[model samples]
Target: MSIPTQPTDPAATIPAVGRINWRAARAMLISEGRLLARNPGVVLWTVVLPVAAAIILGSIPAVRRPSAGLGGLSFFQLYQPILVFFAITLLAMQALPDVLTRYREMGVLKRLRTTPVSPTLLLFAQLTLILSVAIVCMALMVVIPPLGGAPWPRNPGGFVITYLLGAWAMLGLGMVIASLFHNAKVAAGFGSFLFFVMQFFAGLWWQRPNMPVWLRDISDYTPSGAAVQGLTDSSIGHWPRALHLIVLAVWGAATSRLAIRFFSWE
Candidate 1:
């Protein structure tokens, strides 16, 4: 007589990312890019207006002149950072959450669990695509202004750092929106609400420098307020305030934690 060995389930052996699988991640990223290219309705709308606004503002000599009402900064200078952030806010709040919620609704994330490709890989792919789009949009806003004689940011390094941190924070918040709302329509409505709030703090309708001291102090702690101010400081040849950097970092960390905690593949 021979002893019999129990059969192992092959499905159980496929791990959910013990280590980062770069190859699978890349393939998924490519796949995501294709899907985005096929249906790019919201992203284009979110990105184009801000880029055009930046370029147009930079081109206008009047807007570049120092304005006493704007606290001695040119209108373009004050608005540039706000406009830059606007594109990012829309992409993160509206575009990112919409896609993610839809993926969950369609059972994409749940199906990926059985494959060698983990859902984490899919998330990395989505994030990469969204970030790439944001960066390209940012670059257009930054580069195209000079052709019309707008000045580049005085502290390029500082500006880039702050912008990147700000993007991370916003994207993380977007992830949280996806995690909370399974219904795509509900997620979209919430995202729109968030977008408007961010713009309000970014000085879309009211300039930060013009806000009352108490209100401005409150705004300083929010991601949009801190990021816009940081970008403004860098553009004016000053380093970003440590307070703003800390605020942005904290928001990024907290939002990412919440998203990961609550997000469900099913």
Candidate 2:
């Protein structure tokens, strides 16, 4: 066979800068964000459901009426952040698994594999979407409750730190679940079970002090329990929010490493 001459155009001979790895990463982030934003179920779970839960929970006659020791802060105020945590927990648990599995099933992951970007970049992009949405939800939870008669965080710094730690913990837990589950559906079911278990035993619907001493102590060690305690303490003096933050950070780091290590592209 006769050899053919090379193309004269450098553009045809070499890949453009736009085709580089960083560029591919940016594109992946944008694509992943758009896709997550477009998912109706995700939209409902992340945005609408939390607000709905807060509203419904706050409407209960007992919750609307304040009792002793419970800050005049309505149930909405107390529950809003918890609801935000719930939303983050739900979204984080299912988002990665669902997106990864769907893309793998659709050949998207296979095509992405041929690109300059690593599969890890795509996964991070999805995580970024979930976390970004979570921050927005936190903002809404913080802002709306104050408008509805909830007291502002007396120690805004503590509130911010504690909430962020809680968010990280929730994200870590979700990533762990996603890593374990092969499909979005399984992750979703598992997430629901985890949420109910955590919320019920923690202080989501009521006060932890009401529980037995042993249960209270155990609950204090849980991420959800720490979050509620840290948040509640924001109204009075800043308590040892450090413990919650530390526990959450440790869990987050460990689980995040495991998630990355066990993450599957197939």
Candidate 3:
């Protein structure tokens, strides 16, 4: 007796076979942009808070203790980058979790599942939104502060380098948070908690190098710490800027890999 073989359908046989529809992706992006623009709370947290924090925090006589030739720089100049950092951090963490939860609840992801939308592409879309916000926030951070007489960056190249690296590092961190938590509440809570904790180590409250030995050691390894170092190095050249770059890149890569592996559409 001879054994029989079954034929396969080329499309059905490939489990992960689908190219993204750019039109669909573009539609998704437009929808996301509209949603972001319409949400008052999102606007408050993403835009208003950072500006308030920078000015409010910088205004505090205590917080204005200057270093790194900061005496020569105006108060707004010292705090401008910090404001952009806070805004980027805030937006990146909130974007994915809120969007994913709403999508899952609304059947957006489910409907998309039937199409050629890859998980990676969806992730990329979220990143693009965050990047847009970060860029805008950064522009505001750079431009608006100057209106208040903030000092211009002495080294524009260094400033650009720091902001780009730091933003991506936070973006990756946000993705990891979104992947780990299933519901919007859990994701939001975790993201918020981690944001505060990271901000502490990111030199928001105090310089990382001045922290206790154990804390300093931990800060050296965390994404926010690396980001703080990178941003600070843009003005004050203590460590080789390359080391901070490497740290941010490593965090971005590791967290992103973990996020992709554990991410769930549901």
Going through the candidates in the order shown, the clash numbers are 0, 0, 0
**Highest-TM-score candidate:** 1
Cα RMSD (angstroms) for every candidate in the order listed? 4.3, 4.6, 6.9
Q: What is the per-residue lDDT of model 1 for residues 51-154, given as tens digits with 9 covering 90 to 100?
A: 99999999999999889999999999999999999998999999999999999999999999988667988888889999999999999988999788988999
Sorted on lDDT, highest at the top, how do the candidates line up?
A: 1, 2, 3
> Positional deviation of 119 in candidate 2, in angstroms?
1.3
Per-residue lDDT over 1-266 for candidate 3, one digit per residue giving the tens place of the 0 to 100 score: 87767556666655554655788789878877777678657646677778666645544554444555443433444455556677888876776666666666676666777766754566677689778777877776566544544444556677777778778788878888877887878888887888788778776776554578798668867767766656655644334267678887888888878877887777
List the candidate 1 regions with Cα displacement exceeding 4 Å. 1-17
Candidate 3 error regions (>4 Å):
1-18, 55-78, 236-240
lDDT of 2 by residue, 1-266 (tens): 98898788867766654454777679888987777657657556556777666655644556655555554555544665567667676666565556666665576767767865667777778778877887777676666655655555678788778777877777777777767776667777887788777786556766665667888788777878777777767744465467767776776788788877876666
Q: Give candidate 3's whole-model lDDT.
A: 0.69
Question: Against the true structure, whose lDDT is highest?
Answer: 1
